[model samples]
Target: MKSHSEMKEIATRLKRDIIQLTSANTGHPGGAIGAAEIVAELYFNRLKHDPSNPFWEDRDRFILSNGHICTVLYSAMARSGYFEVEELKTFRKVNSRLQGHPSRHDLPGIETASGPLGQGLSIANGIALSNKLRNNNSKVYCLVGDGELQEGQIWEAAMTSAHYQLDNLVLIINWNDIQIDGHVKDVMNIEPIADKFKSFGWNTIEIDGHNISEIQSALDTFEINNGSPTAIIARTVLGNGVSYMEHEAIWHGKAPSSEEAKQALEEIGTSTFESDLIY
Candidate 1:
């Protein structure tokens, strides 16, 4: 496992990979860029699994519920050695294992195939229940998008998780304000989100998603034996690390041009990921 500083540097570099891969203009980058730190922390220092043995039983399961931002997961998985990092450029391309949305068939580390919103929590809840029934110590970690909370299925899943008392279920919400259409508040407000989760009987926690220490601290805090599901609302900036893209909804599904990618990489303090292909 790498140190926190090392993990953060990887995250910065991962953002460069995400941008470079999505330069073909077919992948989502805004939320993926924002959730870099959270994913990096989990892959580097937290997750209990061996990259050499991706299917080892008793391994913790990470379910990416908001699948549109798969760039974050794929890049993190590559860095974690699930696959080669250079394959990132094949994103959204033909015969690419790193699909636009994650497919369980493509990656050994991916636990579920997800694309339509509001279903990841349900899948995580079921996996948590199964683990508990089997007396397995492995945990089920689910990453949800704040915009996805507007879906009714998520609330249903929340109720089921609370009722089941799935203490091993940990949910992390990427609470970036912008989504595909516009600001989440303007589209369909899910305000008082933390409070909503609390009312649903979850161990709700909030943190600055970009701060690796705080994210690690929050995960450590929830590492205790609590008899309820945990939810971490990660407040983050959309399109983080790029000046022109930060907090912009338009960048949600857009890719950067060579010039824009160069500027983005320069602003993020790294240019080693430089690429030239536009297609």
Candidate 2:
């Protein structure tokens, strides 16, 4: 397990990579930036995964339900040895495995091909249930955007998880208020998030998503909890590490220009991880 500081540095590097990758091509960056810490803790510290052996049978499954923010996921995957970090430059490039959204067929570590809103949880449910049937003790971690809650399919999956008592599944809600259209509340209020999860018979926990320790503790709690699935409501700022982008709905799907990315990287500071590219 990595120390909290090391994990934090990894998140910082992830934020930097997110900016560089998306700025090179059009892609969503806000939610990806906001969830950097969560992704860091999971890929670098918490998840039971082996990049060398992508199809490890008992490895934990991480489903990016709101796949639009996959820039962070891609960064984490490459940094974690799922692929060469150098390949990151090819993001959204023609015939590159890294598409605008994650594709399980294209990427080695990706658990599923995700893009359309509100389908990830259901996919996770199927995987979790399959694990249960096989008596597999591996956990399933699903990350969903708060804005994706507007989809009726998400709720249906929520009910299914609770009803089936998928204790091995962990659901993380990236509760950053801003979506592509605007603030989530302005688009469609999904407030009282934790309460709603609790009502669905889930064991819910709320925490500051940017806090590495809080993220670690929440995952720890999920591991210990039995008889119900866990839902972590991680409150976060959209575009967390970038001043101009933070909490601004406009940055949700907007790629930073070369100038904007330069500024964002300056604000993010130097990363512990070495980058192949200077920018």
Candidate 3:
């Protein structure tokens, strides 16, 4: 098990990878950076996954619902040994397994092909239910964006997850607030998000998305089988580490230029990863 400090180092590396990968090609950088800690903690610390055996039947499933931020997922997957870390350079390139959005067929560890927004939770619900029926003790984790709450289908899936009492399913909402258009409230309010989940019969937990300790604590809380689905409202800054990008909607879908990436990388400092390759 990785210590909290070690997990934090991994998160920092993921953030660096996010900037480098997106800047090399074109991809969403803000949300991926924002979600770095959460993804890092899940893949390196909390999740029961086998990077060597991607199809291990009892492995915990992690579904990236808001697929636009796949830079972080791809980074975590490579760093954790699902594929070669050098493969990150191929992201968004022609015939690359790492695409703008995650495709389960294109990638070994991806649980679903997500891009249409809001559909990930529904798919997660089905997988969770199936696992439960087969008496598989594995859990299914679905990561969604707070902006994605605008889609009516998300709420429908929330109901489905709760109605079935899928204790094995965990929905993690990246509550960064910034979306492509603007702030979530300015665009479409999804406030009282936790209450809505509770109303739908879920066990809700709120935490700082960047706090690896708190993230681990919440996931630990979810492991006790409380007879309800779990929802973690991870409060985060849209562009977390870099000062110039934080809280800005413009960065939501914008990749940094070479100079911008250089500045961002400097601000993020160095990680243990030795790859000199930008991507």
Look at candidate 3 and tell me the lDDT of residue 98.
95
| Model 3 ranges with Cα > 4 A deviation | 273-279
lDDT of each: 0.87, 0.91, 0.92
Among these predictions, the greatest lDDT belongs to 3
Higher-TM-score candidate of 1 and 3 = 3
| Candidate 2, superposed: residue stretches over 4 Å from native | 276-279
Model 2 quality (TM-score): 0.98
TM-score for all models, in order of appearance: 0.95, 0.98, 0.98
Looking at model 2, the pairs that clash are none
Candidate 2: tens digits of C-alpha lDDT, residues 1-279: 898888888899999999998898889999999999999999998899999999999899999988899999999998999998888889999999998898888888999988899999999999999999999989999999999999999999999999999999999999999888888999999988988999999999999999998999999999994899999999999998789998999998999999999999999888776563553
Q: lDDT, candidate 1, residue 182?
A: 94
TM-score of candidate 3 on Cα atoms, chains taken together: 0.98
What total of clashing residue pairs does each candidate reach?
0, 0, 0
